[model samples]
Target: MAINSLKRLALLGSVAIGLALPARAQDSGPLLDLLVKKGIVNDQEAEDIRAALVKDFAANTSAGKLNLSPALTEFALSGDMRLREQFETQRTIAVPGTASVANERERVRLRFRLNGDLKLQSGWGAGFSLQTAQNADSANQTLDNIGTNYGIYLARAYVSYQPSLNWFFTGGKFKNPFFTTDLVWDADINPQGFAETHTTFLNGKDTFEVRAGQLVMKDNAEAIAAGAAPTTGVDAWLFDQQLVYTKWFGAENLSDVLFAPGFMFYNASTITSQVSGTNKEQAYNGSTKYLKIVTLPGEVNFANIYGTGTQLKTYWDFTYNTAANDRAHQSVANGGYGLPATTNKGAMSWLVGLGYGYGQGKNKGDYSLKADYRQTGISALDPNITDSDFAFNRLNQKGYKFSGSYNLTDFASLTVTYFITSRLNDSINTKAPALAADPTLSDLNSTNTLQVDLNVKF
Candidate 1:
């Protein structure tokens, strides 16, 4: 028998057993013996086939290798780990009804995440990620003397379909679809919903995209107890739509520039204080309800700036709360939880940021520096969804943030970040009375946070 034909037959047999070539060849010794006995092929030819299978396996097992099948066109795995030490401090205005006048906190936190991706033949794909954390806003687990075991959760699990090169749809818990800063949606928030994006290539150097998504923020089961429809209570939800445009300017010497501008409209369903429990709960959970928020986000980036293998980026984000009055109405209708009724008006918030060097470090000595300034009005943005690490996640606070990072190796890095909110809305009559006891925000004047992290990825 021809050696090539015998090799093909052996490969088929191995695939039937779901084993790769080299391992399959070794396990096929009995079949080869039978073939030799039947005079189908001599022992020498069988040995040669086995040797060729080994060579093929050796050639295939390289970096980025995948064990592919008819149904599984591609597969990949990746993950990261981080260790952090954080310190936070805040001072209050010392009103009579408050419980505490000052706050200080310190913690050591760690985070790890692992992800898997799969691509099918019919333009469909799925992804799953496991992350350490019990909270949606953070993947960090704090180390404590109690020897508390960390928790791992399903941070992301989504299925995607790409009907064409220009359109894509995804469902399940996935990354946020809107182009935004952490001002509204924290980087850690993976919204659970259906999301879609369509891209149009305007020209060789320009592109436009439309992104939309609807997220279910909360599902109240109060109806079950009240003997009503399942959707009786306000099913907290968010609707988002955005248009993004991008243009690439030809390189200027060693630097290439790109400018992107985007507009987003975010809407929330009924946010009633009746169901939102205490003052803290109302502030954090019900803040997004009954509001129309519009955002304009713009960015300019220069790659290889100064020819030092660096990139410079600047961003400006402007947000207007069209329903701030509505939120204020809800607040006043609820008796302002104890305060006066003078806080009823829509508000705005703006942020400007500058970044230097590679955004995410890649190699040893690689570094990044970033600074951002944020000014927020009382009713500006959704407080519940903002970055928790920023000023203890307070709204109506003005602050500056500074961050720097340096890579220790290709997959490991050290980073330091500091945030200072010098001004805050702490007037007793301006806030609900229930919040008067919470030292973290109520009666707050200013707060500061410092964090150091050692990050590793693969």
Candidate 2:
């Protein structure tokens, strides 16, 4: 009986409240009055009017809907693509060069890149980039090959771990720590070896960076021969190391140019010469005091060029970067020659280079111009087939490039460039007459190559 009485009292109270409330609230009357009485909608109505949203919320609340979770955010993706073309011209007289000059050939290449950023609930985040080149990685040549197929160039692939400020480590292919232009390395199209970088600070608004790694080398036997030289090419091991340092030059972006120079140390096996077994090379056979009248006359040091030889090859190079507007060209001049630091009877050579650009000045003209040059260090050139001894000499190289660009539009442009080089004087070949006597064939040396190419990137 008490329970029934309580239920009736509750029903009567609900009925009394319903009767007292305005009937217009249940009808299609002004919704502002209900909000105004509940201290919501203001009189001037400056607040935004979300009609559908308020109606849905009201219906759900009336239906006894209790919200527990928050709404999900959206994931977005972005990418870009580009096309490129290249052409070359080679017109030269007969020269016994390493290979035939590649003729006038035209090719088109394609490139694409994609990026994804996953924003987690925590402040920490992760992302990756998938890139591709026109020359697909193939095991063999094919017909109708446009370029490398569209595949994961994997320019960078890594899971970032960031638990502090200005600190991160991504374990995978990444931008080389070396400071240089993309066109020189086209770092975007190909992935290099492993790399790492660390940044520390000085006073406020100041920081420093350090990077280092190794690259694949040792594909040249010239290096192996160098090491054996008191006798030849500096012998090098299979790989090369890289190191660089960068520091904040000044304060804001206007003064933010970085100064970075790098160095490397190689780990190579020493080379030595062996004089036993089949190597009866008569060249320096214990400095023959009594010359034999027979075949020994033609024997030279390299008669046993096959001997086991061991030696050390080492060098040091330093490069510097300055502000764009700063006058620094002369300091970066090319074509250098010098003797080895070590007294081991061998030689080491080095050179550095820089260039200037004008078409990219403040003028919004339709065309641009740039000039640049680079050089190789001094080294020995193979001349006489019978000269088994290594001679230290200056045989440096040089190259120059001229370029112009025409603006097609905001996102497109036409570029044309001419690259050329002057012939360098190698060691004087005294043995040419002896070898040229053969009426069947002859060998000659000359240097000249020209090229033209087109590039498009975004």
Candidate 3:
């Protein structure tokens, strides 16, 4: 049986080489040819290799070794949402609202998510996820031209594989490389379809894991001078790579600390061209340009926290950021182009937070105080057409939040979030006109929002 498996593997390897992957990936030639020529890797050796790969794939998923099974893997999920009440305060009245007093409103939202991993017996595993959430509307899905409590959400899916320990591959709708938390506005919503590094490192505890992959984004291509792009494909220029390391800092009885930190970079090509490695040359003929739908500039995070699996844990997280202009919209002022300059454009931003959690097993409760600040250098009039263009235009968006959650039971929990935002734009183009409308533009242009939510998880 083992000998027969070797023959099959060798034949498959030969066919694979005759197809798509880069030549070097196949070790420069087909398996049969190599074996025949080398006079090595005997049939016996081939079987050993096959068995090793099978073991490696399992180890990769459970322990990390060589091959990653292309099998279907699914995750069990259940989520529930209670009710919500909101209060908004805005001093500037569009017309005469009769009073400047803050107004309150009633609304309800459904938040639920589930994912599955399907690894076929044929060595082809696919992954899928479904998330239902209602946070304020984004610029993505909206109707009636008004940003209301209407259902506006994100749906993403992707497929991945680890053909070998040193190599991995993936394709589909997913998250971009930079930043943490898929829910840019809400952390509960996990994003998808991002290619990532599957490397391992030895740390004190369970070793450090790293993932680096391309980020697929949308819009802003023309605005950034990245001529012609696929509506739904990954932008290699926009890469997403992360590094995470977990360990038991102290003794088993003492508290433990888990630290995951790394850098982020997403380069949406402003111009089309053949990019081999780090070099980007100019391309005129219509071709695919990399694009990732994002606003927050690339960032660096040093998240440190100490806690245990039982309950009651504490964490202190520090985050540093570099400004990125909103490439979604552009004007003729910053040179008819939209991307910011290599220097004077996107400024710097950072955030620091401290928190504590209480719970047992999956049913957990927590609270925290977080402060965030980000600065954009590109003026509203800036262009994203040239390589020098900044991804985000504007300056100084700073805020603070006090949020908490109480798990009423295994199936229910209550959450409250409060935020204060302040903006400081460059006086020159601070009031620049917007090229695209915000999906959440509703009863008012701006106001402070207070939100409350209850959730059930299974």
lDDT of each: 0.70, 0.32, 0.39
Off by over 4 Å in 1: 1-69, 96-100, 226-232, 253-289, 331-346, 358-360, 426-443
Best by lDDT: 1
C-alpha root-mean-square deviation, each candidate? 6.9, 20.4, 15.5
Go through the candidates in order and give the clash count of each: 0, 23, 48
Error of 3 at 23 (Å): 50
- Which candidate model has the greater TM-score, 1 or 2? 1
lDDT of candidate 2 at residue 408, scale 0 to 100 = 59
Which stretches of candidate 2 lie above 4 Å from their native place? 1-79, 90-102, 115-153, 181-194, 214-257, 265-369, 378-397, 404-410, 422-458
Q: Provide TM-scores for the models.
A: 0.79, 0.44, 0.51
Query: Candidate 3: global Cα-lDDT?
Result: 0.39
User: lDDT by residue for model 3 over 85-115, one digit each (tens)?
Assistant: 5444442222333443444443443454555
Kindly state the number of residue pairs that clash in model 2: 23
